[model samples]
Target: MTAPTARIAGEESARDQGLARGVGLWSFTFSILNGVVGAGIVALPASMAAAAGGYAPFAYLAVALVMAAVVVCFAEGGSRVPTSGGAYGTVEAAFGKGAGFLAGIYMWLASVLACGGIAAALCDALGALVPALAGVGPRLAILLLILGGISWINVRSAGLAAGVIAWGTVIKLVPLGLFVAVGGLALLVGHDPAPAAVAPQGGHFSEAMLLALFAFCGMETPLGASGEVADPTRTVPRATILAMLCVLVLYVAIQVVAQGLLGAALAGSAEPLADGMRQISPALGLVLLAGGILSRFVWIGSDVLGAPRVLFAFARDGMLPAWLGAAHPRFATPHIAIWVHSAIAFALAATGTFTRLAILSTLATAGLYFLACAAALVLRRRGVAILGTPLSFRILPLAAGMGMASMVVLVAIARIDEILAFVGLTFASLALYAVMRPRIARAA
Candidate 1:
């Protein structure tokens, strides 16, 4: 006999109540792009250059391909589940409550760390533009202000948040596109570095690939927003694929421009794209800097809006404190979860460095992705229909599984500290899960 149909709890339904489906194809595409690109593309070229020399662009393409493989796996999982917990929910079904609980905790921590990093980066960009606020107090204040503003907007309405994200994405892309065009022209004129500048040295592909992985880190945010979409199964997969494609194009284009202009020098510069533009035309430097700052707003907004919804999802499932599932009665958003996540993010921003936090976040998130891919394979093998529903893409589950496994290998070899931290955190979560299991089982 078929298993019982899964029902969303009263609280989960409350949080989702009156939440109009404002995200269509373009809005969904914009949200995904805004969520994925963030501030990474601005910094990634230099990071890749340090490792792969000129072949950095190829490294990005390779990373994108690997991520795409993972995305396909996610698409299948999402098509089946289409819930807010995203990887947490998917892994739970494939593995068990214990493993699923651990995955949820890691994903929550990753989102908190990542949101903090993004906010701090935005504050840094603002400080750069307005040097008078170089003092610690002013910068901290600015960070809080930005975070508070984003939280307020997100808490207001999902539709409003989508519009902000969609517009912010357009604003961010325009300057990057201009830089690529101008830089390409300069290279053709022999006014910039030769193609040899971007060519990889004898043995640095692995390092370059790791840096490229950073650029593709936030591609999963759209999945987190599935509940807010009109038809999640269709929109989620399309948004995931479309967003990945947009990011891949923007990243590869930026790398080509940066490398063609400054070559190895691009790797050394703190602001590689801006520096490349400066080489071509000083005026373009200002434009690129402005663009970076604008892009951070989109990142901050998307993170604040998306991350809390995941928390709410977990809470509704009794995996987290019940209070976290509280929604804004009128706004139809997870206001309590938003505030809780914001508090954690603010604390992390005040304390952690970007590099350190990013490493930790990437590891945790990658672990979840790895599990999600595995779940797809497991479910397909067991012939388990997700959400008591049929699924498309039978081969996707296996591809996602292999892709995730390969990423784990890469992370182990390249980011050993992150891997260790993730494992430690996971074990700690497992201990908590063991204690909570009896309670969760009783609730079920």
Candidate 2:
């Protein structure tokens, strides 16, 4: 048989032609950090404390423990396929082109809607940062610059974009890191009275865990750049695991510090992190204000690096127009795909219509994770490996099983509107798949 990594007889791998394979272990990890640790981190402690009490950190830890299993499936899929595909190449390997096509579009649609919502939020954030940008003309300019700039960078080079995400990660982390460090110090010196025992509340723990799930939601985002990652067979797995652990540690520490410093008041403060930092010193608190802005900014940048690759991946597989998968000769990047994705987001941001589709967010996340875990089980059982050789991970079966159960929990807790949104999107996507499958087979 031909080597597993080989493509179609005529079509070439993007990496073989112009797609730069330059993203390394740490940079991809940074991309993950930037993606997962968004603006929500700053505001999360207050709600978590209210719901889970001092056990707030434990609730987040509980979610992370479950996520560890889920990332294993992602790790295996990415290692086996090692391509720039949606979810992971293991999906198509398990389910074939038709189902794979559905999964691919499913994720791409979510990204498009998410990008629009994020873009609008970014504009509002920038407006808050610079009062001068509040006018329609100024806000429009901000949107253009933000979206256009990120697209230009990604189109130019995935490596360059990774570098930007690295700095963006640090820029946002400073305030959060400060909050943890200073707050911990405050406790040490008895600058604040000892925090009350925040024992876990069983009745509310489940609610808190589900809410905490969003903080861990972006693990799959950076994997979209499978085509550009260097040593992906090992790199993807390591980054996925490490980035998650780091976030879990960081989140738990921040929660502990906030709980110790703010105590009962933490459960009520709307701006817990910012307020906590302010208590240390006014200047530090002011810096935390910029934290939210920087966090969202980096998230949008990381999102640009991620979600477009599915578009490029589909086009490369002949499920979409080939032009989208074409790599830029000079930059070795998917410029066309990047531009097109950005355009959809820009339109959505400008019109403010992406909100209608926003309800799909939770359901879309559940579907994607379920598909990935299912793919992992199928691919492992089929003994499939598409990357010439697969890394040996002894925990595949156990991890995948647990991942599926975690997904079940996610779906079990989803609200009714989310279920409706999921059903609507599924029917619509399957109908489109039916119409397109025949043409693709005829072409083949």
Candidate 3:
């Protein structure tokens, strides 16, 4: 007999209470884009320049190609499962409940830590505008306020949250677009691109590819929102691919423009994109700064929106407390889970432990991506066709293999402290899993 299928418990409640299947293709695409391109994009070109020197833009493209394969694997898994837990659901469907639990917890923890970083960045942005907000008390207050605002937006409805995300996407790109247009004009008028003296090498190129991978970290947002989409199997794959393509173009453009203008100083500048724009015009840099702040809002909001759904998925599947899976009677949203996520993120951001946790967060993200790809490969080998159709390239196994290799490289490149931390978390989670094994087995 085939393996048992694990499912969440609240499908009818979701429909009756308030969740609707109305997200269109455009909305879903922009939502994923919002998740993938955040304030991180503003800072990436600099770090990439540090790692890969003058060929930094090429690093972005190489990693994008690798990540695109990973996306295809996730797309296949999502098309099969198309549930809230996303990678969690897909892995469990192919592997078992045990594997699913690990994936879910890993993703949830990573998202919480990432939210802390975003909150801190937002506070810094606020502090830049209002110097008095730099105090610990005021910073914490503002962080809590922003976190609360995001929770409120997500708790009400997914549609409203998606709309906010879509609008934010449009607004955040305006400054970047302006910079690119002007920078291109300058280049056409005999301005030299890449005035930097550093040259690229193989070792640095690999390191840069690894660094750029994190920039694409949130590409799984569409998978997380699958349950709310109107034709998830079709919409998910299309949206994921399109979002990746758009982001790839944006990342390369930003890197090229920033590197050309900043030259030798690109790697040292904290605000590379803004600095490059400043060279063109100081006023343009200010606009890019504003856009950078706005971009943080978009991604942080997307994180708050997506992270809770992972817990909701687990709770519904009987992997965690059922209360977490409960949809609000009136709102039809997972309000409890959302609040819990917001609370944890707020606490981490307030205490500043989130920075330490960020390394583990990257490891966990890589783990989840690897597991999802493996699941897709396993399902394919087992003759399962849950993803509906093969990818246009008809290379599911190849894509999965490439994704797995990338994850290995990422893990290998992780710092010693991050590896130790990841190992410790893995063992602790294993112990917890042993205790929950009976429950998981029964649910399955």
TM-score of each: 0.82, 0.77, 0.82
Error of 3 at 175 (Å): 2.2
Task: Name the TM-score of candidate 2.
Answer: 0.77
The lDDT of model 2 is 0.73
Q: What do the candidate models score in CA lDDT, each in turn?
A: 0.73, 0.73, 0.75
lDDT of 1 by residue, 1-444 (tens): 124113322323443567665678778777677667777677667667877777888988887778877888887777666655566666766777777777777677877887787666666666766888767899789877888878888888878987887788778888778888888888888884623344344256776776677668765666665657767667778878888898888888888888878876776665677778888778898898888878767777767877787688767766666788888889988998988888888887888755556656777777777888887777566655433353578568558767887767777865566667778888888877676666677667
Predicted candidate 3 versus true structure: per-residue lDDT over 1-444, tens digit per residue = 123321321332232245576888898888788677776676667677877888888878887878888988988777666666568767866777678788878888878877886677667666765689989999878987889988998988888997897788788777778878887787668665445465433246756765677677876655665767777778878888899899899888888878778887787665677777777788987888788778877878878887898788778767787788999998999999999999988887787632344545667888889999998887656554432453444888899999999888877877787778777877877777778677767875
Instruction: Give the alpha carbon lDDT tens digit for every residue of 1-444 in model 2.
Output: 243334421132533457788999999988777667776676667667777776778888888878888888888877766666637455765676777776777677766766776677667656655779878898789889989999998988889998987787778888888888888888788867324355334357765776677667766666767768888788888888889889998988888888877777787665677667766787876687678667766777777887788888667656676788899999888889889999988888787622233434544666777788888777666666655566656887888888788867765665676666677888887786677666567656
Clashes of each: 2, 1, 0
lDDT of 2 at 198: 55
Off by over 4 Å in 3: 1-27, 79-84, 130-138, 152-163, 190-207, 227-235, 322-336, 350-359, 386-394, 440-444
On a 0 to 100 scale, what is the lDDT of residue 198 in model 3?
Answer: 54
Output the worst ten-in-a-row residue range by lDDT, candidate 2.
3-12
